[model samples]
Target: MMSFISRTVAACLCLVLLGCVAGQPERLAIDPRYDSVAPALQVYMERVRTGGERNAVLNWEEAGLAALELGDTDTARSAFDEALLRIESVFSDTEAAAKARSVWYAESIKDFKGEPYERAMAFFYRGLVDMWDGDYENARAMFKSGLQQDAFAEEQQNRSDFALHMFMIGWCCQMLGDYTAADEAYGQLREFRPDFATPSRDDNALVILETGGAPQKYAAGLEMSELRFRRGATQGVSRVDVRGLPAYPMEDIYWQASTRGGREVDRIVRGKAEFKVVQESVGKVMTQAGTAVMASGMRKDARKETKYVGAALTLIGISQMVMAANVDARVDARFWRNLPNRIHVVTTHVPCAATLPVVFRDGSGSVVQGGATTVRLLPAGNGFLGRATFLSSLLYGQ
Candidate 1:
């Protein structure tokens, strides 16, 4: 028969197992409205709002995308603001407990703290909204902020320079008549893609279309031997081929930066192999230490049933590990799905009534998806910009 202490220890172990399972964030349900968006977008947005506060960034991101689809620029801006605020809060917390919690439980809790690309997009999209509202001053400021993020990313070597953000910054600066800043922005872009073409000053109306979805996150696998845990990977839609009739082909830019400035600093690589190895090593030490404590307590019981106690505790530990693995493995998979995978800059003399027809295709050049929207080009001084008339249609695939 089990002694009081052994029975109590077993009960506690069971509770621990249960706690691991219970602590997992809830999976989000598909929002019906997501069906109305593009199929690729549907898959992306459908999963964004499901994780609750643990997924606050994703929630606001989805909200912003949905608002943009509906042409509600105000709501989209508000949602992006909230998303950025959540992201800022994560890095701004100086408390030891908060920091410890993040280190230990960030993945298991599903509290996504924004990837580099995602963070920059927050500023980029906000800038786009400002431009949509014809607020060039605020738009320029937002784009500059986004460029600063790119520079920071470059300095930290967290990610490659974001070509789209850089182009947008240059475009914004051009609109603001800051040709020097515009040249600087374009110059940086040229460093990435040397043969990239710039839109002529005489061109009117810039049509930017985001096709296909960003990479989806998925659980790679759990490695127990080396104490390595592979949590997330870029999955789902790989590459998209977009063609806008009567549009200029935009350049695809890619660049890398060094992490070591002058002296070497211990930097954290979030989702890479080295980072996962370190994370798992820490987790393994903690788990084993914890299991050892519980086992020791069980052995101290008067009952000679240490085998049974050990078995129970072992089961509990395994169960807890599995639960944590499952939870941690569940990736956020949320990103700015509405942003154009390809951008086309069309420069043509705008007639009183002109429409731009844009089409999206897969790698095989099959028209798997297409949008029906006719943008009216309005003359803005020397150049032309698309009126907000087609914003809803462009965004909603109408």
Candidate 2:
């Protein structure tokens, strides 16, 4: 009977090792035929095509950003829409979430919905796409949604402090001639970020400067159950000056990432870690005790009942050890890698047939070489909007 129980436990352990062990997902590979395409775009395009549903949100985000940068609004719109659809879906229904709650699965098993900041940026890009399409109402909605997503910051005081989205919402309202709504949005923006200048009705063009790189995420703590963020570097540009308006720092992506506090799943992972520790300690003690009992039972003076008891305890201890070893408490560290470190904004009118002058300055306010010098306004709805991204180190020499 003892031998039969031992075989059953061993078979179960084998099944777990063979079928339930978590494996890393396959990395996206670029085909050699697309060598002529820009490397970033090529990689993002490949990710969108091959990453499947588990990585769908992240893949689409990279693809959308790349396409948007290349002036492919149609593709960017579609990618952002797909990503938003998945992100806004019920969290409980996700495969990663379902599996992650179990002791045997890692949190990375879930689909990539991204951190709050990444999710908010999705709406920011989609809003821009809508703005370009003259859908001011939808654009306003997207900005508002982004604000809602940003409101989930871990610290209560930090929640809903994303002044960039607030400003965009106001800009969208102003474009639609809803001055009252615009006033409300601008009022909120002033409440949170007093330094930002409120745009006047005559201010028609908005310039957005996306500078620097994204925050980095990694797993730490016991069983790798804690999620942490490292601040991303901002290259050469520290201050920006546009010819006709105040270009001030509106959002810090790293601050948003770091302030997002803890997730509910974090507690769940920690609990699993504690359970594993307890099980391991108990199993070790029981195995040691069982071994001592079995050794005594092997003596000629020991009774048959003692031998049976020792075998049962040994089997139980082995089963507990197997279960403890199967526990997985790793945190999901998946993130949007292509996001900007900081976003600066300026709102003012641009004349027809005129270009807006932009100056990217380093820490000492000296103009950065090779940085964006001018931006041509794009006609949107009844007005013009100018947008440009200036990378400090990536695109210019300091």
Candidate 3:
């Protein structure tokens, strides 16, 4: 028969497992049909509706990506708007208690708040939505907002400058016919990426290419031993690689400093290929430590009965191992999956009413067979905006 202390220890161990399970963040069910967009959207929307504010933010991000894939720009815009707003509300809290709780518990209980690049890309996508709607002014505003966010990130984290955002700013100015502003933006982009290519004055349309999904997270290479744990080692956690797209071409231009109020535009455009470690899996380490501590307590309590103590210790150890294996240490794999892995720009004049063929190729230079789309040029003022024949497939992939 078990002693009072052993019984209490076993009960407490069981409770610890239950508490961890209960505290886990809710997750949406995956759809079996990989190509079906509606079911995915439905699951995400349901999570948002029933999962409270934090869940709403995460699910809204998924919903926005799905809507973008489906060519429902309006829905995408609304979802992204709500997501950005909710993220701000949660992370912007300045209360002392909230800060303390966040430090201890925020990451393990909720969704990923996104890294600087991801957050800045949200604004870029919003700007694209506005551009598709012919709202150039708002599009420009969104791009500017993205730049501001990048600046904030640089100030707070000392992150590298985002050349992509700078290029977008120049592109927006070029579309707006503000040559002076466009030149200045392009000049800044050159400073970041010395080999970046600038668009020609004669080029009419911009083709943005997104390819491949972001890297998925998984648990691997865990080193958990009693000695290591005793030594305060928390090395059993998740890690991710720096995933980014390759760079492509642009044209060269020379601008006189005196022409644009002494604002010098650089003579070259350069390609940028940069990546960084976005999120770490410290939560897994914490979870592992917590489980170990509980198991240690149970073992200490069962010390009196040799045979029963071995059994009790074995049970505790097995339970914790199982729990750790089951814990989804995979960082929230949810991301704007449809966005291009890399963006390519080309400068060419499209004749009025011409159909511009856009082809996509992988890193090996072979064509993604079904990845070609045609854009019908519609003259807008002195330039052109394309009406993609298969816009959905072009933007999100088949």
Candidate 4:
């Protein structure tokens, strides 16, 4: 038999050879659907090499994830907050990052908002959170914001269906007063949805579709409605439609089908996409909207203001903006809907001259613009909330 020391030595050697230990990153093409953590971690690590608040952002995010995994809500919140601040620096230029980060920042808004999706997903019960947490209104509002990005697309329809996921979507819509659509969503489901996590992808394919505004339904349709250190005011919005198959519920794990039937089944090609809806909200005589840009040495920083601009809304709300159809999909593609540790900040002073570093698209769909006009790289609209708020504060002195 091998001696204790010999066994110990062998284990260590094995770990090193397998790239299991030694604090080294395991180079693997991660499947985001399985665990979104890897992508988040990789980005954090690369940014940390340069160091600063960016460093703090990564550390806090990791710690928060740990705390969350362990059920330590307090620690998780603190870490999340820290992460938010770190990534909050850019809101304008970094488009891709803000895409995903926006979900994080939305958690708190109108003083009553929470990152609709993130806050809901902080636990295994995202659907419940979306429905019960006094959030459905904001959820609807959040969806509205997503449309502003013009990221949704036609190919997104007929996404894989998960009974529970559709239930969650329908339920949120129900709470938000979209009973008709809610019912319609429910009608499409094959069974009643449960409220929890599961172990496998199995037969469930979940998907979400995003619409801007209140989506005025013909008898039926209608619609409605972020960021910063200043806190309270809602600005910039993005919608992400998570339509597709939701995984099998943990309770249903035993219900899976056996492959013994010899039935040939084609794997469904389900996907995620986003769109920028509406046009850029502009301001006018009686309204205040769009960013208020100012020159250097000016007492106040420039601010983007909006009234209620939708491409269709121009006849009414001048400042309301919407992303047009053409470039919307491309922009949504920038924010792959999955990045990590989104912190949002506003700029106290607009840079004299800002230039983004050379951007090579990462799978995340955002361009890493270094010099200026960027976001938490655009995970959320608030990715640049910090900068926007900072400039707003500097200029308006509010």
lDDT of model 2, residue 306: 81
- Candidate 2 local lDDT, 284-376, one digit each (tens): 888878888888899999997787778888878888998999898888888787778888988776666357788878988787776658876
Q: Cα miss at 362, model 3 (Å)?
A: 4.4
Q: What overall lDDT goes with each candidate model?
A: 0.51, 0.81, 0.49, 0.28
The CA lDDT at 320 in model 3 is: 47
Give the higher-lDDT candidate: 2 or 3: 2
TM-score of 1: 0.60
Which digits, one per residue and each the tens of the lDDT, describe model 3 over residues 45-97? 66556555445555566667667666666677887887677545544444522
Ranked by TM-score from best down, the candidates are 2, 1, 3, 4
Q: In model 1, what is the error at residue 18, expressed in angstroms?
A: 4.7
Candidates sorted by lDDT, descending order? 2, 1, 3, 4
After superposing candidate 2, which stretches have Cα over 4 Å from the reference?
1-40, 91-96, 244-246, 294-314, 353-355, 368-373, 392-398
Off by more than 4 A, model 3: 1-40, 50-52, 90-106, 152-160, 217-338, 351-355, 362-364, 375-398
Give the worst 10-residue stretch by lDDT in candidate 3.
267-276
Listed per candidate, the RMSD to the true structure in angstroms reads 8.6, 4.8, 13.8, 28.8
**Candidate 1: lDDT over CA atoms?**
0.51
Candidate 4 residue lDDT tens string, 110-150 = 11112222222222132222222345554444333322211
| Higher-TM-score candidate of 2 and 4 | 2
Give the backbone clash total of model 1. Answer: 9
